[model samples]
Target: MSEQSNPIRSAIAEAIADNPTILFMKGTPEQPACGFSARTVAALQALGAPFAAVDILPDPRIRQELSEISNWPTIPQLFVKGELVGGCDIITEMYESGELAEVLGVEEATKASDPNVAPEGQPVQAAPLGIENRLR
Candidate 1:
């Protein structure tokens, strides 16, 4: 079917295009329904990054459509500035290295929400590398 006829695809497109940071996850960040999602949420929360999250579990088509669009067959798919930034493990590593904060343009904290702020730094310019997290 054409994307015009598929509301799910259209919605996914609009959401990705509209939001600077969005996560197509299995559940809300506040209550992630899966372990990977929970970890992903925690990483974003640690960075204090505000993101729009879409729960793909509510509709099977949402996951399918998102996968088709992103060409990444996984939930908890993170998009930063309209670009895919990989899934749980990548996010965790980036969070640890403070790359996520740079990507989100937030002040990189030595620790999450620590009072002692570090000097302003530039974001690491890196291409999105896909790390498949097919484990359920």
Candidate 2:
């Protein structure tokens, strides 16, 4: 981003950079404040893919800044490798068709989404619950 951007924009950029797969939604992944957010979380969780979520409820400014950063006027936005992918609808479709796993580079897309899959995917490999909750 250019230096002309605001400080908050810079912070959002930094946050997204720190996380590999990011979801800028209306609430936390575990306890989503909105139906869309909850569904979005479920989609990713079902894929058993590692990802980081960001709740846009704390500061309305964050929501505004995110929109400006991505030029997307939606709350439940998805990003892969710092690139804006799509929103909840897209994720849900991907989850159903097993596209998310491919995008995340998981070997067994169906098995990964299956809860029966051993060694369930975690937020962080070396850090336990380090990036667990999105609300925090």
TM-score for each of the candidates: 0.79, 0.76
Best lDDT among the predictions, by candidate number:
1
* Model 2 agreement with the true structure over 9-93: per-residue lDDT tens digits: 7767876777778888876665678776777776666666677777777777779888998998986998888888788778777
Which one wins on TM-score?
1
For candidate 2, the TM-score is 0.76
Off by over 4 Å in 1: 113-136
Clashing pairs in 2: none
**Candidate 1 TM-score to native:** 0.79
Give per-residue CA lDDT, model 1, range 1-136, as digits (tens). Answer: 7866776677777778877888878766656788888778777766666677777886687788888898998778999878999898888788878888898898885345431221133132221121111211
User: Deviation in angstroms for 119 in model 1?
Assistant: 23
Q: What does the lDDT read for residue 113 in candidate 2?
A: 42
